[model samples]
Target: MILAELTIFPTSEGVSVSRYVKEAVKALEETGLKCESGAMSTTIEAPDLKSIFDAVERAHEAIVKMGAKRIHIDLHVDHRLD
Candidate 1:
């Protein structure tokens, strides 16, 4: 499994952070990846690296589409489940 931690600072386009988070989660869900867990705080879950990457890309795109001036993303992976 993989874990992606993202920090997004979107422009003040009247779009709440929660909205971006929801869109991000929806995009991840559309990828058909298993989201074991997630949160609006700063973390998301995916079953594999590919899915995690895809999710990040989708999130970036979504923010851009929403007219975000800038966005930042950070990702972390943990392969050893022990």
Candidate 2:
């Protein structure tokens, strides 16, 4: 399993933060990733790196559709488990 911590900075818009977060969460879900928590930020759990990449790509697409001119995403993957 892989744990991904993502921080997304989307271009300024009039849309509500909740809406953006919802869209991001939905996109991740479509990639078969579990959205562990989502508010101003989101955390997702995936079975592998491919799923995580898929989720990230989907999230960027959603942000762009929402009128975001630019988006900065930081992802940290934890591959080792005790």
Candidate 3:
């Protein structure tokens, strides 16, 4: 099992980027993974690293498509064999 914490936002969007954050959360949810949104970051659970990466990519793309030139992504992952 893989548990990841994703904090993604656009630096170029200036302050108050709730719109971009919404799109990122939407993208993550659309990946069909287990996602929980927090005040600071989002938690996602997946079966493998590939799924986590794919979800992150989707979220990044969503922010990019929203006209964000500079984006920041902070991802923390924990992979447990048990």
Candidate 4:
């Protein structure tokens, strides 16, 4: 599996982005990826890069739909054969 860590948020939305975060979470769910959300970020596991990319794309779209002109996304990936 490909393990991915994603931190997606708006840089200029406001002090709190709980609403947008929720939206992103929803988008992630819709992508059918295994995801766990933490206080500062979320971790997702996918079978391939396509699934991870789809999740990330959906997440970015969610933030943009929230009216954020500037968004910050931190993505880290770890791929293992075992």
Candidate 5:
């Protein structure tokens, strides 16, 4: 399993990005992965690396559809065989 944390945002969207962030969160949640929302980032647990990347892509696309040009993502992943 992989435990990951993702912090994504549109850099050109000004200081407050709650609206876009919420959309991304919704998209990710719809994936049915184990997830938790936090102030700075979101944490998710997935069966494999593919699952984690897929979810992040969905989140990114969600924001892009919201009129984002340049996007930034901070990701952390921990893979454990156990």
Candidate 6:
């Protein structure tokens, strides 16, 4: 199992980015992975690295589609074989 913490936002979007964050969450939810949203980041549980990456990509695309010129993504992953 893999647990990934993701923080995605637009650097060009100025101080307020709640709308973009909400779009990202919606995109992540569409991926069908388990997601827990927090104030700083969103935690996702997936079966493997590929799944996590794919979901993150979708989230990025969602934000891009919303007209963001520059996006920043912070991701931390925990992979456990046990």
Give all TM-scores, in the order shown.
0.65, 0.78, 0.98, 0.95, 0.97, 0.98
Candidate 3 residue-wise lDDT, 3-37, digit = tens: 99999999997899999999999999999999999
Q: Please, what are the lDDT tens digits per residue for candidate 5 over residues 61-80?
A: 99999999899999999999
Residue-level lDDT tens digits of model 2 in 1-82:
7888876656575454657766877787787667776544677787788888888989889888887776778888887666
Q: Which 10 residues in a row give candidate 2 its minimum summed lDDT? A: 9-18
Candidate 6 on 21-56: residue-level lDDT in tens?
999999999999999999999999999999999999
Shift in Å, residue 24, candidate 3: 0.5
Each model's lDDT comes to 0.65, 0.76, 0.98, 0.93, 0.97, 0.98
Model with the higher lDDT, candidate 1 or 5: 5
Poorest 10 consecutive residues by lDDT, candidate 1: 33-42
Task: Tell how far residue 69 is off in model 5, in angstroms.
Answer: 0.7
The sequence of per-residue lDDT tens digits that candidate 4 reaches over residues 1-82 is 8999999999998799899999998999888788999999999999998899989999999999889999999999999988
Give the clashing pairs for model 2.
none
Candidate 1 local lDDT, 1-82, one digit each (tens): 5666665546555566777666766665677665543454346567667777777788678877877776666666665475
lDDT, candidate 3, at 33:
99
Global Cα lDDT for candidate 3: 0.98
Alpha-carbon shift of residue 12 in model 4 (angstroms): 1.0
Model 1, runs deviating above 4 Å: 7-15, 36-47
Which parts of model 3 have CA positions greater than 4 angstroms off?
Answer: none
Candidate 5: worst-modelled 10 consecutive residues by lDDT = 73-82
- Candidate number that wins on lDDT, 1 or 2: 2
Q: RMSD of each candidate? A: 3.1, 2.2, 0.5, 0.8, 0.6, 0.5
